[model samples]
Target chain A: MRAPLAERVGNYLLLIVFGLFALGPIVTILVAALGPDDGGSGSSGFGNFGKAWEIGHFGSYLRTSVAVSVSVVVVSVLLSVLSGYAFGTMRFRGAGVLFYLFLVGIMMPTEAIIVPLYFDLRTLGLTDTFWAIALPQVAQSVAFGTFWMRAYFRSSSRSLVEAARLDGAGPWRTLWQVLVPPARPALVTLIVLVFMWTWNEFLIPLVMVTSESLRTAPLGLAFFSGQYTSGFTLLAAGAVIVGTPVVLVYAFLQRHFIAGMLEGAVRE
Target chain B: MSSPPGEPRKVGYLYILPALLVYGAFLLYPLVRAVHLSLFEWNGITLGKFVGLSNYADVVADAGLRAAFGHALVLIVFYSVLPVVIGLALASVLQRAKVRGLGFFRTVVFLPQVIAMVVVAVSWRHIYAPDGPLNDVLRAVGLDSVARGWLGDYTFALPAVGVIGTWFETGLVTVLLLAGMARIPRERYEAARLDGAGAFAEFFAVVLPAVRGEIAVAVTLTVIAALRTFDLVYVTTSGGPGTSTSVPSYEVYHRAFELGQVGSAAAIGVCLTVLIFVITLGVNRLADRSTA
Candidate 1:
């Protein structure tokens, strides 16, 4: 049923207000990025993007971000699927304890672990390396992904698993050939979230990497802004450069993103 | 779904072993080590003497540390309280009036969440500059006296930082509430209307009770965000303007890396963790009680 015209106008007005509030800063930065560099060196329009890319050394940073995000997503998604499948389908000894251990990883904040983690990794001569940045995030993502995919697995079709087993399919065959195809939505959600977290992670890369070449996009953007404090146009362009990849992925997969978030809220 | 023929009861352990090992080494081990290190007085490079909770004592007695925790509490207002209220109001309005382009609106609002916090900080830092758009607008409207460098002002730095949190979080909370509100069966809204319920009354009788779970989730998430806020604070103010914006997480980094106070940093980290747990549990319990 439609509301009265007065109420409808109010609704539209409120929505516009909120929409502007959310998109204003983003648009402001984008606009500034297109403007001429404040230092009178870089060209106007999209030329600023190229200038920022070179000056900020975003090529190297983006490469590292891609490497870290891809590695984390691949490893964590695989691990989460295996563990979630086991937990959702099996009843084994110590399952509860092991799952709760993962839960602690999920709930434990990174600040609490980073100090000792740095010291530990340093002792092992792993600090300032790719593994130091990627591995911890892999573990962190798996902790959440296991919980998410387990919920999907738990509510999945039991008859399908039974049917696969009756057909002489082993656990591996059942998971890959029978169940995973139907679990595409859940997997997509997990992939998107893990990728976003790994890409946007600033703290781990900040604390772990001292090498300029190993810096991720967000860390590079931070340092660039710090050094080029006077060049607003370049800084805005750098911000856009760092932010665009995830935004593109999000725009394409927004359904999975929103669904995963709402599902998390409902589960809570 | 019974075990396959000849399958052992412990076969599940094989699948979980790799994940469990990594998680234990990277997350769990470090957490326990943080706890242990919190109990000692060490510069993180030498043999440590046991302090036996004196670090915890410093967490209590140290004025700067006390103020950092207090700043986190203050941030909860802008981060959690304000956003939840705004979300509920927005969701309730939209629930009462079915608006077109709802999808477009939701997508636009949720965009900030996808951006990196460092980028968000940079954009807002430009906006909050002394001669920035905010001050420019203020001068244009003859409110010039109200304008200042928001993140640099001693009085306004924390609130300026908090407002950024508000901007970042409202979208998540609103989207969650909207999803929750949408699930209320139309028949219930009609039933409330049939009982002579106005918008406020209908919301109180129906929409409010229905979305308690989402509200709880939003609160929990935002409170956690506020407490664990390091990226935004680091990039924006770096706890500047004379520790006015210093938070526990920022302290966790600065004390350990800059000040060589590894013991105190660990102690602060442990305290922050305990605070998160207690507050999360409290919110969940309150949500449970209200819903029940």
Candidate 2:
């Protein structure tokens, strides 16, 4: 089934070009980070990362981002599994209507709701706190997570559930003891997606928290770039600092990430 | 009476309650409130006056607002159209050659999607700086006259921003289409060759139809990404060089936070939401029809 040698070579050439396009910016930034410090004045190597970490206050921002992402992922994954189990395994009144409501969360642009969401959170005195950033994102991630896990649960082994039920196991026990263990792959995918989205979210933390310490990594990076416009090395190092965790996670769980994305696309 | 697993009793409602509560409180409620706010002139602090549809009217009449929406549409060309076209071409090449390192290519190509948009914007902003790699390359090639600040140039800013979108999105589209194209049976390709169909003819007769659904999915995701582009514009240009790269999402933030035009901002948000819905619905309809 192989094509001619020339065509194969041409394919490789094109793939290489596209690969360069994709990898070029990432590689350049990494290289620039390791080059030197601000204005190329300070010592070279990993010192830039240290300086950027201190100056940008990335330690605080990364902490905020981690806290927000962890809270969002934990709450949303648990909620999505519960709800997805319902939608997948059970047919109840208003199921269709409720599922469509969840779909609206998936489809609704953040621009549509962010303004009111800010005001609403502010009214409750939740703004400028971690809950303000984490809770709203929990809602968003749960929306998509429910949809994703529902698809997984619906196609999961039915006989296992039936066997568990015949043994007098309750619905909760069936889900936890019988089904959830085998659903590790789907759960991992949900965790990865929700974590990435929560980590990379910009506009929410931008508007929700005005305190300098509460700023997430992306927000802090944006402000840092603005402040250090000419400090290319420092800025590049800061980007690496802010971006490395997600990159590392993606490198490890890329299979789940890709599978979830393609599956989501096809289902849509 | 006990119920089957597929038809669990009213307790099913309880299983969904927690998620439904949070979703409604944060997302759904805010959406409704945004629509409600769109109809009034509120300073965001005081009790607002009702302005009826004047905010919507303002969105239509204001030239800058109109231009912002226009920039989003232009971005669709770069974000959705260009990526899909390039993705199709790349997938076809791989399809023909049965590429060996497809897994490696997919991983590298899909890397951009995983990074933060702010990081993407920062990296690209560096590349587009006056003396950045791009201009350096141009000067190296003796095209020094063409070298300029890309994101600072009024005319080039939008496309410069758009090209970044293309770069970030092309990999996603390509990977998605490749997944779709891989499902085509080998015998179909062999049959097409037996019919003496050339590459173009084979693409139209066999490949295009097979991946129609993927194209729609790509368009939906990317078009939505194009319209909802705030982080990129916010980081890269701030809709700068005279609002040349301003988009609705950015305007939604700028108007409310900066200009104190909450009502108009809400109106634009409502419009953007509707625009996204209508366009995606239209895309799905067209895709379904052609495949049928």
Candidate 3:
């Protein structure tokens, strides 16, 4: 049946409003990045980008962020995938209780535990290092990641696992050879989601690492803005530098990202 | 699907061991320590006397913390209500028509979600500066009288920052609502159209009911985020203009890290967690009942 003209117009108008609302801040930032420096002295050019790159010392910051984020994603996905296979495919005593215990981590926001985590890291002598940031994030990310992978695992056919078992495949070999291959899409989805989250994370890194040398991109942006108080163009340039990778990743993988988020949210 | 029998159970425990150990060390242990620390008055570096509920009393008595929490509640309107309404409306629209470049539109809408909050805050801070783009636009459009320092002013700062939260979070809400909308069978819409339902009527009767689950999920997540708002406030105003824009998280950060009042910080953190639990439980229960 053909919809009425008024409805179509109204729908289009609604979409346009939301589209502008979502895109407005980003466009504003992009313009600011390309606009003249805050003093209104220099003409608009790529000058801010060069200054940001030089003064912000973003080279080291970029490396630290990439290392930390990649480490967290790789560790988180591996742990979640293994745990998910066990929980989703195996019959185990106390499995239900253990899985529910993992869910508790999700309910407890990182902010709640960050205070003691600082002290704990200090005692362990791991403070001011990449492990301090990477370890906690991996732990936190694993809760959601495991939950996601578990859902993916549970939805797959049990007959496959049974078939693997009958074919003389041990549990590890079965998971490695059979279950892991089928779970590739879900694994990719989790990796991208976790990568994006860890990349954009700020508070944990800010609280954990006090050394300037160890700052992540988000922390670097915070520090850069503070140091370049009057240099709005440079700050904008820094934001772009920090925000660009995730934006680029999302541009290419929007569907997978959205699907992953929806899957994570809808399950409970 | 129940787990089979005996052998795999051993493997399951081993599989979860690493995650369990890490969570215990980092997440669970710290939480317990935070609670323990809430009972003492100590700087982060040095141990002090046990205060035993005095810190909680201080948090309760402090006007600054209370005001910060009040501001956080105000933020809930921006973070939870505004984006949710906009997202639902947008999702409703997208559901009705297949716009050209819909995928591109979705990408643009979801862009802010990928950007860090610090970047979003800095960007908005510049826009809200006294002589920034917002005021420039206002002046150019002949509305020069209305222009002001959006983040620097006492009256406008919190809402201004809250609006950024709305802007940043609306896309997630939109995506969730869209996913929910997708689950609504087309037959229901067809039936509504055949019954001479107008767009509004059909939306109210068909789409709204179907996406109730999505709405619940969005509100719950957004409310949690609103309560925990810190990065934007930290980057923009640092809860400045006499703490007008301070939220609980910023207050906790300040109390613990900046002032060396670890106990009070933990108290605030504990209180914030309780508040979140209450609010989330209430929302989730309502959502559960509706979907049930």
| DockQ of every predicted complex | 0.63, 0.66, 0.63
Interface Cα RMSD for all candidates? 3.1, 2.8, 2.3
Q: Which regions in candidate 3 have their CA more than 4 angstroms from the true location?
A: A1-10, A36-44, B1-8, B193-196
Docking category for candidate 2? medium
| Global lDDT of model 3 | 0.83
- Stronger candidate by lDDT (1 vs 2): 2
Please give the TM-score of chain B in predicted model 1: 0.95
Candidate 2 structure quality by residue, lDDT tens digits, B209-277? 999999999999999999999999999999999989999999999988888888888899899889888
lDDT for each candidate structure: 0.90, 0.90, 0.83
lDDT of 1 at B114: 87
- Which regions of candidate 2 fall more than 4 Å away from where they truly are? A38-41, B1-5
lDDT per residue, candidate 2, A1-268, as tens digits? 5678887788889989999999999998999999966575575789888888888899999999998999999999999999999988997877888887898788788899988888777788998999889888999988998898888888898999889989999899999999899999989988998898999999999988899999999999999999875669989999999888988999999999999877865545
lDDT of 1 by residue, B1-292 (tens): 3332223457788989888888888888999999999998888788988989999998889999999989999999999999999999998888667788989888988888889999999999999999889899999999989999999999999999999999989998999999899999999989999999988899899999999988888998899999999999999999999999999999999999888899899999999889888877788899999989
User: Which RMSD values do the candidates have, in order?
Assistant: 2.1, 2.0, 2.2
Q: Please, what is the TM-score per model?
A: 0.97, 0.98, 0.94
